[model samples]
Target chain A: MPPDMPTEPIRRRIALTDDGPILVHGPIEVVLTDGKTMISDRAVTALCTCLRSSRYPICDTSHRRRVRNVTARGSGSGMDRGGRGC
Target chain B: MLSSTSPRPVTAPALPAPRGPLSSAVLAALRGISAAPHAAEIPPGAVGQADPYGEDLQLALYCCYELHYRGFAGVSDDLEWDPGLLGLRRQLEQVFLAALGADVAGGTDVAAEIGALLVEPVDAAGVSHHLRHAGQLWQLREYVVQRSLYHLKEADPQAWVIPRLSGPAKVALVSVEHDEYGSGNPDRMHARLFADMMTELGLCAEYGAYLDAAQATALAEVNFMSLCGLHRRLRGGLIGQLVTAELTSSPASDRLVRAMRRLGCGPRAIEFYAEHIEADAVHEQLIRHGVIAPLLAAEPELARDVVFGIQASTLLADRFADLLLSRWAQGRTTLRNPLPELSHRR
Candidate 1:
C-alpha cells in the first residue's frame, strides 16, 4: 500500500449512534463499522465534535481521539497556568 | 463572493423578494429602481413584529448589509456607496443595535467576560450537541449548510478592522487572520474548507446559494459581524466578535469533529472541523493574551466598546442557537427549504 493509503483499508463510516456530534471529511469510499459507506466527489469537510462516532465523519466507528496533548502536557496544573502546558 | 486572487470579480446574489413595506423599499433601491430611502414612509417602529429577531427586519437589514459584502448580482457595484442605501442601513442598524444593547447587560471586566466564555455550559444544547448524540448525517449536513453563510466568508468581517487597529493589537489580530486565510495556501483557507465541505455534502458549492433559504435568525448573526466590521467606530466590537468566536470555537469544533465521525462522514468533511479543534485552541489563547489584552493595554478607553462587542455577539449567537433548536424540536426544517428536497434537487 502507498504511504497515504491505509495499511489495511481500515473500514470507516460517519454515523451518530446516539445524539453525539462527530463529522469527518477526507477521501470518499470510507466505510463505517455500522456497515454504512459515504461515497463522495469533492474532498474535505467538518466532522462531529462529539465522541460517539460509528464510522466517524464517514458511520459508526465510535473512535475518540481526545486532544490529550493539552491534558497530557498540562497534567495537575491549575487554570492560571493550565494553558502553559506545565 | 469576489476573490482577490480571481480576475473574474465575485458578484453578489440578486435581491430577495420583499417580505413587507420595509423590505419592499429596500429591495427596490438594491435593484436600482429607487433613488432615495423611505424616510417619509418609515414603518412605524411599533408596527414591526415585537421579535427583535424578526424575519422582516433582519432580512431587510441583511439585504442592506449584503451590499457591503457582495452586492446584488445585477446591482451596480456603486450602489455599495449610495447615500440612500447607507441611510436605510443606519435606520435598521439603530433599531437592531438598540435591541441588542438592551438585551445584553453591560460589563466592565473584559478578562472576566473572556473567562466566562471559555467555560461552556455543562448542559449546553446546540446543533453540535445534537450531532454528538443521535444527530443524523442529514441533520449534520443541514447544520453545515446553515453555517456556510458565515464560514464561506470567514475572516472578512474582522478584516474590516485591519485599518482600525494599530500596534501589537493590530499585529496580533492579523497573525490570526493570516491563518484563517490559509496562511498563504488558498486551499487551506477556512472559507475554502467550508466550501469543500458544502460540496462534499452534495450541496451547491456556489457562494450565497443558501441566502434565500437562510432565515432572519441566521442572517442577522452575520450582519452583526458586518455592522461591527465596517464601522471604524465599532472596531472594538469587531475584536469582541472575533474574541468571542475564537474563544468558543475550540470546544465547539471538538464537538463538531466527533459529530461528523459518529455519522460516518469522510475525511474531507472532517478536515474543516479538525483544523478548528486545534487552530482555535491556540486562537483562544492568542485572542485572550495576544489580541485583547494588548489591544486594551494600548487603548484603555476602548474597554467599554470591547465589552459591548462581546455582549452583542453573545446576544446574536444565543438568538441564532435558540431559533435552530426550537425549529428542530418542532420536527420542522430549520431552513426555509427542507434539506430532503435539496438532496433531490441534484
Candidate 2:
C-alpha cells in the first residue's frame, strides 16, 4: 500500500434520472455481455438505460422524447434508430 | 504547463473591422485614437436609438466584452478597466438586456422550461436539421465560421458563474467545465478541438479569425452568454443558459457528426461534434440533477432569471439559425465576408 492511500473501502454512488441515463460516479470499467470492457474516466458517467444509444453502454441522450409533429425525419432524431426491435 | 515549443501560442487576435458608428467608436476607443462615450456625455436618445439587436449595437457590445477576454492585439491590456470603456459597456448591456427582457416570455418554472427543451418536435427547422438533411459543404463551412466565434472560446463565458455559486452546484458545474477543458489534457480541450476542426475544414483556426466574417446574429448569441455570466445577479440565468446548451447539444452534435460525414469531411473535422454527442449527454444529466437541483434549492428566488436566461438564449439561437437557413435557402453566404475555397491538402 502507498503511504498516502486511504485505509477504508470507498463506496461508489449511482444516480437515476426520471427519464434519462443512470449516473455513476466514475473512473469506472464496465464488462459487456461479450466480455469486452468499456471505461469512462469522467467525474460522473451517464450509463445508457434506454438501449437506444448508438454508443452502447454510454448515454448519447437517445432517451429524450421525440415529439412526432410531422412525417419528416428531423435533426432531433438520434444517431441510430435501427435499435428499434419492432 | 505549456512548453515553449507549443504549436499554438497565445497571441491576441487583431481588431476586427467596425460595422457601424457604435462599433467604430468602441474600436477607436480601444485603439486609443479617441475616447469612448461617457454615459453623461452621450445624447439623450443616442444609445437607445441604435437597433438593439442590429449590426452596430451587437458588434459594439461584442468589442466591449472582448476586452474582458483575449483583447485585441494592439489594444492596451490596461484599457480593460478603463472607466470610459466600462461606462460604454454598461450602456450597451442595458440596451441589449432591455431588448431581451422585452422579447423573452419570462417565467420561474425551471423544471417545466427544461422539460420543454428536452422534447424535440419532428417539424424542427433548425440549422442542425437543415445540415442533417440537405446541406452542402459550403453551407457547413459557413456554419463553422459563424460558430467559430463562440466555439473558439467554448465554456469560457460560463466560467464567470463559478464564484457566484456554492456547495454541490458549484462542484457539479466545475466538473462539467473540467470535461470541457479536456479533463486535464490540454490537447483535448474543447476550444483546441474546435480549432482543430476549423483547420481540418480548411478554415483559419486562429482565435477570433472569423470575427470580420460573422454576422450580428452570431455575435448576439455569444454576447448573451457574456451578459448573463458577467453579472452576478444573473447567475441563475447563466446556469439556465448553460443547461439549455447541454440539453440540446447532444442530438444536434449527433446531427453535425452525420453532416460532416455526409460532406466527406475527415475524422478530425468530425471529431469535435462526435465528442459532443456523448460528452453533452453526460453534461445534460450533471447540469439538471447535480447543479440546477442544488443551486435552485438554495437560491429559489433566482428562478425567474434562470428562465429568462434559457428563453433569451433560445431566442438568440433561433435568430442565428433563421439567418443561416434563410441565407442558405437563397444560395447566399451567411457571413459578412465569404469564405475562401477549401484547400485540398489531405
Candidate 3:
C-alpha cells in the first residue's frame, strides 16, 4: 500500500488526555484487535483510550463525569441548567 | 451565499420583509427607495422606545448586521460603511445592551460559567430532548427551518473576531473555524452540510430563505454574534458566545441525532448533527484551553465581558426554546408563516 511505502520520518504531537481520549495531531490509521482498521483525516484525531465513547476512538464527551448526588439535592428549589419548566 | 476568494467582491441574499418601522426604514434604504439614508425615518431618536428583544428592534438590527455578512441584492456595497446606518446601529445596540446589562448580572467567573455549561442537567427537557422522545416529524421540520437562518452562515459570524485576537487564542479559534469551514474542503463545510440536511428534509436550503419565518428570539441570537463581532471592544463577548455554543452543542446535537433517528430521517439529515457530536467534543476542548485560557491569560480585563457574552447567548437560546415548546404545546406554528404540511411527512 502507498501508506506503507517508504517515506521520511514525520513528527507527531501527542497529548495525554486525563481519563479521556488521547489527542494525536495528524492523519492516523488505527488497527483494532479484531483486525478492523479505522482511519481519521482530522487535523487532530482523538483516540479514546477509555473506550467509553459511543463513537469508538472518537471522544463524544461521554468521558465527562455524571454523578447522581441524591443527598446534595433539596426540595428542587428551582429549574437547573437545561430549560425544563412546564 | 458568497464564493469570494482573495481580492474579490462578495455577494449575499436580498432584503427580508420588515416587521415594523425599524425594519421598514432599513429595508427601504437597502432598496434605494430612499437615497437620503439620513432622511429615512428609521428609528430616528426612537431606538430607546423600541423593545430590546421585540420583533421590530431585533429584525432591524439583524438587517444592519446582514450588510456585513451578505448585503441584500441590489444594495450598494458601500452602504456597509454608511455613517447614518452605523449611527442607527449604535443606537439599536445600546438599547439591546442596556436591556442585557440589566438582565444578566455581569461577573468575571469564566471558569464557573463554563463549568455550569459542562454539567448535563438530568431534568433537562430542551427542544432536542423533546424532539428525541415525543416530537412529531412536522415539529422537527419546523425546527430545521428556523435553525437554517444561522446554520447557513455557520462560522461566518465568529470569523470576524479573527483579526481582533492575538497569539494562541487566534490560532486555536482559526483551527476550529477551519473545521467549520470544512477543513479546506468547501464540500464538507458545516454550512454546506446544513444545506444538504435542509434539502434532504424537503426544505428550502437557499440562504436567508427562511428570514420571513424566523421569530424575534431567533434573529436576536444571530444579532448578538454580529453585535459583538463588529466592535473590537466586544471581542471577549464574541468568544463568550462561542464558548457557550461549543460547550453546549455536543450533547444537544447528540439528542438531535437521536431525534432524527427516532423519526426515521434520512442519512444526510442525520449527518449534520452527527458531525456536531464528534466535532464539538474536540471544539469544546479547543475553546476551553486553547481560546478561553490563552485569551484570559493575555487579557485579564476581558473576563466580565466574556461572562456577559455567555449569559446573553444562554438567555436568547432559552427564549427561543421557550417559544418553540410553548407554541408546540398549544398545537400552533412557531413561525409567522406556517409551512405547508407535506402528505408524505404526515
Model 3 bad stretches (over 4 Å): A1-9, A67-86, B1-11, B43-45, B341-345
Comparing 2 and 3 on TM-score, the stronger one:
2
Q: What is candidate 3's CA lDDT for residue B47?
A: 69
lDDT of 1 by residue, B271-329 (tens): 88877765565455456666788888888888878888877776766666776667667
TM-score of every candidate: 0.76, 0.93, 0.90
Q: Please list the C-alpha lDDT of all candidates, in the order they appear.
A: 0.67, 0.83, 0.80
Docking class of 1: incorrect
Q: What interface RMSD does candidate 1 have?
A: 12.3
Off by over 4 Å in 1: A1-86, B1-9, B41-51, B340-346
lDDT of 2 by residue, A1-86 (tens): 89999898888989888898899986899999999999888778889999999988989888888876533322112222100000
Which of 1 and 2 is ahead in lDDT? 2
> How would you encode candidate 3's per-residue C-alpha lDDT over B1-346 as one tens digit per residue?
2344332234467678888887787787788887525534554566668899999989989988988988788889899998878877888899999998887857898887887777666556578878888888888888888888789899889999999999999998998899898887766789888988999998988888888889988889889998898889999999998988887787778888898999999999999999888888878888888899999999999999999998887787778888888999988878877776554235
lDDT of 2 by residue, B123-169 (tens): 67778878888888888888888888899999999999999999999
lDDT, residue A18, model 1? 30
Cα displacement (Å) at residue B81, model 3? 1.1
TM for candidate 2 is: 0.93
Model 1 whole-model lDDT (C-alpha atoms): 0.67
